[model samples]
Target: MNLYFPASSDKKTVFSAIEKYISDQQFIIVNKDENRPWGGFYVIDEAQAGFFIETWFKNVYDPLPRLQEMVSPKILVVAPGKRLSWQYHHRRSERWKVIGGYAGVVQSFTDDETEIKNYHEGDVIRLQKGERHRLVGLDAWGIIAEIWEHTDSNNPSNEDDIIRLQDDFGR
Candidate 1:
């Protein structure tokens, strides 16, 4: 947990460091997205992130069931002053927990109107499906624990589900 990324380090370097740390911790990093306009993310195994659900039936309980297909959890690291694209998903909603630093979130239920809010560590924000939303890093690296909740159980959301309306990097 004593990872460090110098201020001058590039995205690739930061991501590589994170990957190495994850590997050293015996956690499987399923994906690494380092080409984003803002910050990047690492999709890790659910168990590594401590994502588990307890189910109960007939006075009995199962404490180790994981909804891997219904949810995708990732850590989003946003660079200082950078923001994600104004986007929405058709098949999933999202819950973001601010885990490190501060962040600004912009959200809109309608395409023409939006609201912005700032959050700090421990704050939680929820974005429903089809809600236009974006995450902005404040003055430092913003780290967020995000969980994608797929609306349809049969089809989980993926990167292709993103519908970007505005992007600073022209993605």
Candidate 2:
């Protein structure tokens, strides 16, 4: 569960270490821990780098819109009083249409900067790439239609995409 990265480690270096540690589909065994949302980290084995290219592609470009597609859309049903992780994506931007119920949208730039906004049905909010954001269901269950598109990028496959600064589900 623990690996050391040098202070000067770059993104590729850190990613390589993670790749080496978690490659196999069933490489590790974990025991159930009801108290921890993630169960808990148990054991790790060195695994063959069988799917690096595929993993890298998914990590970076899987969400890119297909040719002739206008936008990739998804519907999220958030339970009452629940919230998404505080996270940011490097490769995509999103627009959230509050289709039902109330939504509390929280966003931030720096650690010291934050804004919380409330939206009701038919309201919309835009999130730019790399902007930390979270959506909370208020009072009742909430429904959102999330429309997103890939950001302009030269490589578009650098492998570091959704960076969760904080996660309620411990993921």
Please report, in order, the local distance difference test score of every candidate based on alpha carbons. Answer: 0.71, 0.53
Q: What TM-score does each of the candidates earn?
A: 0.76, 0.55
Candidate 1, residues 1-171, lDDT tens digits: the string is 544344455767667766675577565778878777798887877665442111101111134224655456677888878889889999998878775667899989877536669998767787899999999877766777677777877877888999989889898
Decoy 1 TM-score against native: 0.76
Candidate 2 local lDDT, 1-171, one digit each (tens): 333333343434444444344434333422211222211122222131123223222333454445332343334545446677788887778777765556788987654337668887767687888888988756554546555556765534222667878888887
Candidate 2: misplaced stretches above 4 Å?
1-70, 112-115, 153-160
lDDT of 1: 0.71
Best by TM-score: 1
Give the Å shift of residue 58 in candidate 2.
Answer: 30
Q: Candidate 1's error at 84, in angstroms?
A: 0.7
